[model samples]
Each structure stands twice: as C-alpha cells, then as structure tokens.
Target: MSETNGAWTWRLEDTSGTVVPVSEEYADQHFASQGDAESWVGEFWRELAEQGVVAVTLFELDRQVYGPMRLDTN
Candidate 1:
C-alpha cells in the first residue's frame, strides 16, 4: 500500500549532519512509495551532492526507514 504525500520523504544533510535547507519550491519532496522516493534520490543525488548534501535519511512520516546514506561515489 502507498502512503500519502509527505509521508515518504527524505531528510537531506551535509557531512556534519546539518540539515540542508531546501528551496520552497522543493519543500514538498514527498513520495507515495519507498521505490518512488529512492528513484527520485538516485536521479537527483548528484545535484544534491554538488549542493553540499553529503548524506540523506529516508523517513516514513516521523519514522526513519534507513539512511544517513553517504552520497560519496568513492
């Protein structure tokens, strides 16, 4: 079953674990399913990394599914 928008989202952060401020237009970065969220991150992670986002955490509402996954390709 799929969750509502904002139910499945990511918490982007830098290497120091500081939350990265997302632009207002990108604030609604929600997904219906985990796969959808993962795919979106896979596609845009490079751009995010470029913007100083070194890691990301997946969330289901207030629940953390998994992550703080490093964006480093090394």
Candidate 2:
C-alpha cells in the first residue's frame, strides 16, 4: 500500500494472507482521502465476497489503518 499527497493505494487479500488480483477498477487506484478509501471497501466488499475474498486490510504507506475485516455478505 502507498499513500502520497493525501492519496492511497489499496491491496485486497485472501484469508490465507495471499494478495488477490483485484480488477483494474479496484487496482492501483489512488483514493482521495482515508475516508474515501474506507468507503470504497464498504461499497465494494460484496464484490470481494464474490471473488472469494474473506477479509480486507487498509494501509497508508507503511502504516496499517485497519482491518482483515471479515466480510459478511449476508
């Protein structure tokens, strides 16, 4: 994950801790703000569920923001 100039890059991973290949729409995109990054997950997590992703993590450069948050597509 990388954050620069108040933007962020995200990584999606599986439960086994392997990085999953996110589609271009969600890959390598820099978010405008931390809240924006988190909101992206909030809205897009169902897609992650469909892709067999069990959890998510947020980072800002080298710092962990939150997560490995379990997906609940109920």
Best by lDDT: 1
Reference-based TM-score, model 1 = 0.84
lDDT of 2 by residue, 12-68 (tens): 778887778877566665676788888878888888778777777777776788877
Assess the local accuracy of residue 54 in candidate 1 as a C-alpha lDDT between 0 and 100: 91
Output the number of the TM-score-best candidate.
Answer: 1
In candidate 2, which residue pairs clash?
none
For model 1, the stretches where C-alpha displacement exceeds 4 angstroms are 1-4, 24-26
- Model 2 spans > 4 angstroms off: 1-6
TM-score of each: 0.84, 0.76
Model 1 clash count equals 0
lDDT measured at residue 20 in model 1 versus the true structure, 0 to 100 = 91
lDDT of each: 0.81, 0.72
For residue 50, give model 2's deviation from the true position in Å: 1.0
